[model samples]
Target: MANRLLEVSDLEVAYGDVRALWGVSIHVEAGSVVAIVGANGAGKTTLLRAISGLLPVRRGTIALGGASLAGPAPEAIARMGIAHVPEGRGLFRQMTVLENLELGAFQPKARANMRQALDKAYALFPRLKERAGQKAGSLSGGEQQMLAIARATMSDPKLLILDEPSIGLSPLVVQQMFSLIETLHRQGVTILLVEQNIHQALKIADYAFVLKTGEIAMQGTGAELIADPEIQKAYMGVLEL
Candidate 1:
């Protein structure tokens, strides 16, 4: 528990009258990959939004590096070592790829490391360097996803939170994307990923949680969850005789 880089306990969030998350608790250990998988509208996005301080928490708590993130603004959260790549690959469309990455290091600490971070990102994603001058909106889907992840690294985040990194990609591209995620973990990055690609997510995750209708349905080591008959039946469309 003390080693957890990101912790959310009994987290509840809502959008006006509608509740999106209900008492969801999850934790990511330092330098490990943890994943949350759920169907659409199952409160996965709400949970990430609350953790990143983009949405207000109606109840519960989010803590990073053992400090509470109760009411900090989104930018404050980013400076405190959390980088969120929300769904839809939120990018500055008209900006050049290099420019988009530059914006990620706007924080004082991040700015200090901007050059090093840019170099590091380019190292991890060589294609980004190849297309550094291209407009972000003109990039292909896989390239755009790479830019999103690369830009998040520009902040020098302690906890990198990714939402649906595998959506809308070819199988080969998805494999490549997962390889980058795996590489990030191998090089000492703590990640909390939300993905609909259940098989690949579990395959790469150290731990996995299943969310349904605003609640955590199951939590276990990725292998444990993957082997569970109920999980296989529901998420993987497996049938038991």
Candidate 2:
């Protein structure tokens, strides 16, 4: 059996008096891609926020490699090997691409290996190397997304969490984004992804969870879910004639 790298058990989260997630549970295995798919209001992003410690958990537990992630701040969480590339591709707008990437390795361990990490990042996204000196805000949408993923990799995370990575990109660029994600997985980064592109997400995932109104509505292997008739109609846009 594959070792679980990250686990969320019976999680409940709220914003003030309003509950956003209820009894949500999921796990990502080492070196595997796990996807969460759902409609916009299904609380997918809320789940990511809670896992990354951006939001406080109202109830339940989140563990990383058997260690509880109950009290660490977001930056501290990054140092503990979980990098979250948020939905907006949160780059330092006025800073150069290289500078943004350098900031990603601010943690002690990652800082020591910064040079190797930069080399790897550049090799993965050569376009970034070409735009190394350019301001982050000036790059095209696709390039910015590439920089976001590359920056997250600088931390040498055990698990990478991505939120809507394909949002606002052209279809061609979206395809490239998924391909890069696959490359990252092949290079041994366990991924926990929340994507609106359900078909592509399912295609690349080893296991998947479908969220509805802040709860897991379904769970199965990627192949199993893809072949399920209900999933095909609801998520894959398949219509039986």
Candidate 3:
């Protein structure tokens, strides 16, 4: 049996009677990347928010490491080793590049391991190191995205949840971002990726789930999903020869 690091069972979320996700289940094995691909408003972001405890869950359970994380506070969830890099690169624009990263390690142990984490982050994003004293707002779009991931990783999270890390970047930047994701996977980070770019996302994901109208339309290995005709037409948008 695979080591199930994170398991979401029949999860649902709503906002003032408007449901976003309904009865969705997904699993992430240790040291693997899992992707959730869907159109806008398909609840991909909602799912990551729910997992991070940033959004309330109306039903179902989110379990990690054999414990139920249901109803935990966002901070509580973060301390439990889940880091969420939301859709927007939510950085402290006024803060220096290094300051924004330090905020990610607010927890005691993370703070204690600050030096190690900082070195790791810098190694992963040398550009950030070069701009360590620069204000976050001054960085370009692609640089901000890299900073967002680096900031999130400073916590040394067991599960890294990224919401469209490739969004709003040039094609070249997106390629660089994907390459970084692959590197992170090889370095033993379990990722839950929510991306609108299906083919690129599937290229690195171990498993994938396609969301349509807030529900999982398909679930399979990355290759399996890529080879699936229905999925290709519905999400991938073009036939793969």
User: Which order, best to worst by TM-score?
Assistant: 2, 3, 1
Off by over 4 Å in 2: 239-241
Per-residue CA lDDT of model 3 for 13-115, tens digit only, reads 9988998988999999999999999889899998998898888899999998877889689999999999999998899999999999999999999999999
Error of 1 at 98 (Å): 0.7
Worst 10 residues of 3 by lDDT: 232-241
Model 2 scores a TM of: 0.97
**Stretches of candidate 3 above 4 Å error?**
239-241
Question: What does candidate 2 score in Cα RMSD to the true structure?
Answer: 1.6
Best candidate (score: lDDT)? 2
User: Model 1 scores what on Cα lDDT?
Assistant: 0.91
Predicted structure 3, TM vs. truth: 0.97
lDDT of 1 by residue, 1-241 (tens): 7687887899889889998888999988999999999888888888888898889999998999888997899888888999999899999999999999999988887899899999999999999999999999999999999999999998888999999999999999999999999999998989999999888898899998999999999999988888888888888876332
Expressed as tens digits, the lDDT of each residue in 59-96 for candidate 2 is: 99999998889789987887789999999999999999
Error of 2 at 116 (Å): 0.6
